[model samples]
Structures are given as structure tokens and as C-alpha cells.
Target: MVSLQIVKQSNAGIASLPHGLVVLFIGATSGIGQSALQSFARHAPSPRIYTVARPSTFASHESLLASLRQSNPTATYKLVEADVSLVSEVDKAVNRIIEEETKIDILFMSAGFMALEGRKDTSEGLDPSMSTRYYSRLRAVQLLLPLLNKAPSPRIVSVLAGGLEGPLNEQDLDLRDPNNWSSWNSSVQATTMATLMLEKIARENPRLSIVHWYPGPVDTPGLAKIQKFGMSFPNPMSQEEAGERAVFFTTSDRYAVQEGLLPVPAGLEVAKKSGGGIFLLNPQGESTDNEAVLDEMRRRGVDEVVWNFSQKVFTACNVQARESKDEL
Candidate 1:
């Protein structure tokens, strides 16, 4: 386990990074995303930070940004209002960024929730939980790839289950069948599919450093809401601790494909890359091997299957969104 002390010590060097690093964050309205945003604002030197929030949360989020501005007067924070559970809104959010920025150095995504009440489908006919966790996140990545590639050292940090990938329900990739759909099944499906798709993207974009992290049992409002359903952890990491670790993941060269970000932490060598050339990290900040399952999936060509299905979903969502606009 990479101790928290080492994590902080490594992150202390964020002060040394060049100014004007552009970063875009989704799902920072609350929970881990919010904490990570705060850490980035506090540490990185004069970073141009963009964070998204839904209409209802925009006012309060702006207030939070105001506080961040007071602490880091050199940083620029832009708030984009969008309900990220829908791919259409994600597209708009990305387009707005593309219009202003030439390149994006970091893309940080942690937008998702556990639907303890069961599946709630968005107007685009996708379960909001899966859409938020998988589809919308991937949509943002797909749209932002061009800008990401333009950066000297691009990094994408996705906070979700990284090492705990499980067997995919190949027969029903989206869990559309009522018989196969459950809260647990959807969460598993989202995490597994996300890892596979991200690995495929890594192969295609060798310069990009992608880290999938599993932050075990964080103390946040999201957790408080779900705890009534019998979910409990004996010792959950504090939000501030997780935020600091997240900053390390975001900026440390230890997690990068090539040495570009801040130097690898003093006593740490670069992390071992997965077969797909991405980082699958455990809660302790150590690299994990899930090749027993991932290798089998890749051999079966499930990655291609996932890519095709995702394209179809995006097409359908685009059509629906356009139709809604026409009606308006």
C-alpha cells in the first residue's frame, strides 16, 4: 500500500508544475468528485479548471468555485451546466470546451450513483445509473480525444472500480432484459465494460495515460444516502484523504505511460502498466492485475463488441436529442 504520507509528499510537488494546465471535470456537484476538484484547485499551479453541474446545483457549485478562487487567485474555474447522465448534455458540454480550448491536459471523471431503488431510465431509454457511470463518461472521452492528443502529456483519471472487474454478461451487454437487470448487476456491468472500453482506447492512443481507480468506501453524502440500505464499512477513508490521493493520481508521473507529469514520487518507480497499457489501481494506490479475467475477454473479442454497441447507443441518443430540439 502506498502510504497516505507518501501520497501527500508526492502531491506537494504540484507547486512545481507549469501553469495553465487545462483540466475538465464531470460530476463535481458533490461527493468524491467535489473533493477531487477542491484538491486540484488548491494544488495545481494556475490550472484552468472546468467543472459540470446540473441546473439545480449550478448556483451552489458557483459558490464553491468562488471559495476556490479566493484560495487560488491565479486559477480559472469555469462551471458548465449539464445533466451528465444524458450523453446529449455531455456532447454539449464537450463542444463548449472545444470552442474555447486548444488542448486539454487532464480529464477527471467521477460522475455516477448507485440506484438502490432500482433502474431509472433516462429519456434516451438508458438506465441513468449505467449512463452516468459508463455511457456519458465515455462520450466525454470520445469527444475530447482530439484535444487530449494535442497535449504534451495527457491524462485521464476515472474514479470507479478498477481492480474488481468481473465477468461480463456478453449475451446482454446493456442489461436491457428485465430478467437480467438489477442494481448489483448494472453496477458490475458498468465497471467491467468501462475497463474494457478504456483499454481499447489506450491501445489506440498510446500517448494518453489512463488510470482507473477504486476508492474503497469513501465518506460522502452519496454514501450516507445508501447506508440505510444496509451498506456499511468499518473504516472508510476520509474525503480529504481520498482527494489528496486523487491529486497524486492526476499529476504524478508514477502513474503515467511516459515521464511527463511531476516526477515519480521520490522512493517510487513508475507503476506497472496493464497488458493494455493502462493503470488498474487499487484503493491503496498500488497497481493490480486482473488479467485472468481481462485476457479471456480480450481473446473472445468482447472489446470490439463493446465498442460497436457503444457507437449504436450514441447514435440513438443523438437522434433523440435532435428530435427533442426540433420539437422545442
Candidate 2:
């Protein structure tokens, strides 16, 4: 049996943030991303936070901002209105930040979705979920590399399953085969890419700390969607098969599902309270690196390959990565 380490809240592994930390959060609208946002503001020394999201969706998030302001009245919040899942939009957003700010200490890339269908390619002709989950997030890192390097104790955290990586369909990197592609398949692919790329980027930019987190099952709104749409992969137990599946998460069955709406405090609290390692924040506070896989990524030129391909993806999309225009 694999020994699973469980960290309790009382563990001494949590670390506090420094003052005047300039952090950028993508996918801060909901789920684990939102959790981290709320938690960071609550714990970090007053920070200048810029979150990238769509303008149409901004009004819906006012209540969240209100609560966050309540927790940390001094928190400086800026909503960079854009669709970060697109390379063009990501480039524009980062450019805007660079134009304004001198440096950004932290870049949190957690924008992704658990799509329940086969590949839905974007206008850029890239797989939508994959683009959002891996490509778009990677683009943010590439564009912000210079700014991240300029900061002290620079860190890039991508919240996805790194340790739980599975087989990569190298032959079909895009996973376009309708027969083979599924949401779970896409997730597995995204997870694989994130694991390989994080190690790759960490190696190339040795000065910057790269962390890809696997926040173990927290009952967030996303979980409800996963339950609703049914997993892309083989789900062993549907609610029909087992009441536990339906019974456990069935409390919110009353609300209308209009294809939108979405956190909880756990993720933010975890991000606020983490310290060492390329942190994969478990339910509790501690983190541990998967040395075996990381070592392999180093041995293989996977990082370079991934980065090259990623840049090619952005290049093919004709996205211009411009710095932000805001004053520091």
C-alpha cells in the first residue's frame, strides 16, 4: 500500500508572507483559485493583487471582493479585465501589469476546467480545456519570466495535479481523436504537461521557486460540476450506483444551473500558510516533492521540449506579450 501522509492544521510547516508582496492570480474567479485568493489576502502582509478575468463576469464577483476587503481592509485589489485562457488575452494582461508594476513576486496559474466532453478547440485552433489548463497558464509564465526573475524569493505556483500524473499521449499531444479524447483524458494530459513543465521551468530558471499543487479533495463548487456532468474518465460509481456519491454532495441540488456561478476558505488558507518545498498543499499544511518524477524530468529534456512547444503554440496564435502600463 502507498503510504499517504496526512497533515493536520496544527502542523508547524506553515509560513507567513512578507509585506508589500505583488502577486498575480489567474482563474481567481472560483474553486481552489478563489480559495487561495481569499486565504492569501487574509494571511499575507498587505499585498497588491491583480486578478485577470472577463468583464462580463466581474460584477458577479463583487460580493467576494467585499468579503476579502473585510478580512484585509488594506489589500490593494486590481481586476485586470481579460480572458486569461487565451494566449492573446494573457499576453495583453501581463503586458498591462508589466507596464504598471516594476516587479511581480508571485504568479499563481490555476485557471482550468474539468470539461466533460471531447476536445473543444479554441478560436486559436487549440484544445479549449488543454489551452486553459496548461497552454494558457504556461504562456503567463513565459511572458512574466523577466518580472518574476527580478523579484526576491520569486515563486510560480500552478494549482493542478502534479504528483498524480499519468500517461501522456505524446503522439497526439492535442488529443483531437474523438474516439480517444475525454475530459478525464484531457485532465490527465494537462496534469502531465504541468508536471513536466514545472520541473523544466524550475531547472531553467533556478532562481525562481516553481510549485505545482495538488490540493486534495476539498468539497468546492467545482466538485459539484464534476458530479453533475459526470467525469470524462470511467466513473466507477455514479449516484445511481452509490448513494454516497449523490448523498455526500447533494445539498446544493436546489439551485438553477445556468452554465455559470461558482469557493470556500481552505485553499486560500493553505496558500497563506505554506512554507517549504515545491509545495503541493495537501488538506493539511505540509508539502513534499516527488523526487523520482522530478529527477526524470531533469534527466530528460522534457522542460525544454515543453517550453519550445509552448512558445510555438503562442507564436502560432500570434499573441503579443506586452508589459503592463500601470505605474509601480
Candidate 3:
């Protein structure tokens, strides 16, 4: 476990790194994403930060950004309005970023939730929870690959279940059948599919350091919601600590594919990558080996299956959005 002290000490070095580091954050309105964004904005030197938020959360997020700017006057924050649960919306958000930035050094994604209320499909025929967790997140990465590749050392940090991959319902990757669908199953499918897809992306873009982190249980608004369902974890990590660790994962060389960001902290070695390449990290910043399930999936070419399926979903979403627009 990388101690909290080490995480904070590493993060303090961010100010020394090159200034104006361009970062794009998806789902930074609340919880871990919000905390991580605050941490990054506080330390990074003259950072250029872009965050996405749905209409409902824009005002509040703006207020958050206002305080961040006050804390670090050198940083610039732009909040793009878009509901990330929709792939089309994600494209629109990314396009906005692409229009202004030449390259993105870091793409931090933590926009997701547990569908404790059950499946509620969006207009594009996707469960909002699954879409936010897997489909939209992957779509954003696919669209931003060109920009990411241009960076000296690009990194993608996905805050979700990385080490906790489980059996996937391959027959129903989307879990369309009601009988096969449940909150638990949906979460599993999202987590498993995310790992597979990220592995594929990592292999294709070897320079990009992708960290899929399972931050265990964090005490946040999301966790509070879960508690309402009579489920709670004992001694959940504080959001501030989680945020510091997240920044460590984002900037510390310990998780990097190449040396560019903050150097690995003393007494620590570079974290190990999965069989297919990206870092599957546990909360303590240690690499996890879930090859018992991942290796077989890779051997069976399940990653490709996931990649292809994801593309079709993106295509379908675009078509649906276009048709809907034409109707008006």
C-alpha cells in the first residue's frame, strides 16, 4: 500500500512539473472526481483544466470551479455542459475540447454510478449507469486518441473497479434480458468490459499510461446514496485521501508507461501492468493480477469482442441522436 503521506508528498511535486498541463476531466461534478480535480487544480502549475457536466449540475460545478480558481489563480477551468451518460453527448463534449486544445496530457474519468434503482435506459437504448461507466467513457477515449497521442506522456486514469473483475455475461454483454439483469450483474459487466476495452486501447497506444483503479469504498455522495439502500462499508477511505491517491496515480511516475510526469517516489518501483498492458490498481496503489479471469478472456479474444460491440453502440447512438434532431 502506498501510504497517504507518500501520495501527498508526490503530489506536492506537481508545482515543479511543466506549467499549463492540459487536462480533461469527465464527471468531476461530485465525489471522487470532484475531489481529484480540486487536488490537481491546487498543485499543478498553471494547469489548463476542462470538465464536463450535465445541465443540472453546471451551476454547482461552476461554483466549485470558482473556488478552485480562487485557490489557484494561475489555473484556468472550463466546464462543458453535457450529460455524459449519452455517447453522443460525450462526443459533443470531446469535440469542444478538440476545438480548443492541441493535445491532452491527462484524461481523468470517474463518471459512473451504481444503478440501485434498477435499469433505466436512455433515449439511445442504453442503461444510463452502464453507459456512463463503460460505453461513454470508452467513446470519449476513442475520440480523444489523436490528441492523447500528441502529448509527450499521456495518461488516462479511470476511477472504477479495476482489480475486481469478475465473470462477464458474454451472451448478453448489455444484459438486455430483464431476467439476466440486476444491479449486481450490471456493475460486473461494466467493470469487466471496461478492463478489457482499456487493455485493447493500451496495447494500441503503448505510450499512453492507463490506470483503472478500484478505489475501494470512498465516503462520498455516491456512497451516501448506497447507504440509503441499507448497504455500507466499514471504515471507508476519506474522500480527501482518495483524491490525493488519485492525483498520485495521475502524476506519479510509479504508474507511468514512460518517464515524463513526477518521478516515482523514493523506495517505490513502477507499478506492474496487466497481462494485456494497462495498470489494474487496488486502492492501496498496488498492482493487482486478476489474470485468472482476464487471461482467459484475452486468449479467447474477448477484448476484440468488447471493442467491436462498443463501436456498434457508439454508431447506433450517433444515428439515434441525428434522427431525433431531424424530428424537431
lDDT measured at residue 114 in model 3 versus the true structure, 0 to 100: 96
Show the colliding residue pairs in model 3. none
- After superposing all C-alphas onto the true structure, candidate 1 shows an RMSD in angstroms of 0.9
Overall local distance difference test of candidate 3: 0.94
RMSD of each: 0.9, 10.6, 0.7
TM-score for candidate 2, please give it. 0.74
lDDT of each: 0.91, 0.61, 0.94
Give lDDT tens digits, candidate 2, residues 179-292. Answer: 668888889888877777765566577666666656555455666667676534343322221211111011111110111101112332222211212444332223444555
Indicate the residue-level lDDT of 133 in model 2. Answer: 85
- Who is ahead in TM-score, 2 or 3? 3
- Once fitted onto the true fold, the runs of candidate 2 whose alpha carbons sit more than 4 angstroms away are 1-16, 230-298, 319-328
TM-score (C-alpha) between model 3 and the true structure: 0.99
Clashing pairs in 1: none
Clash count, one per candidate: 0, 15, 0
- TM-score of each model, paired residue for residue: 0.98, 0.74, 0.99
| Predicted candidate 1 versus true structure: per-residue lDDT over 11-92, tens digit per residue | 8888888789999999788888898898788877889999999999999999999999999999999999999989999999
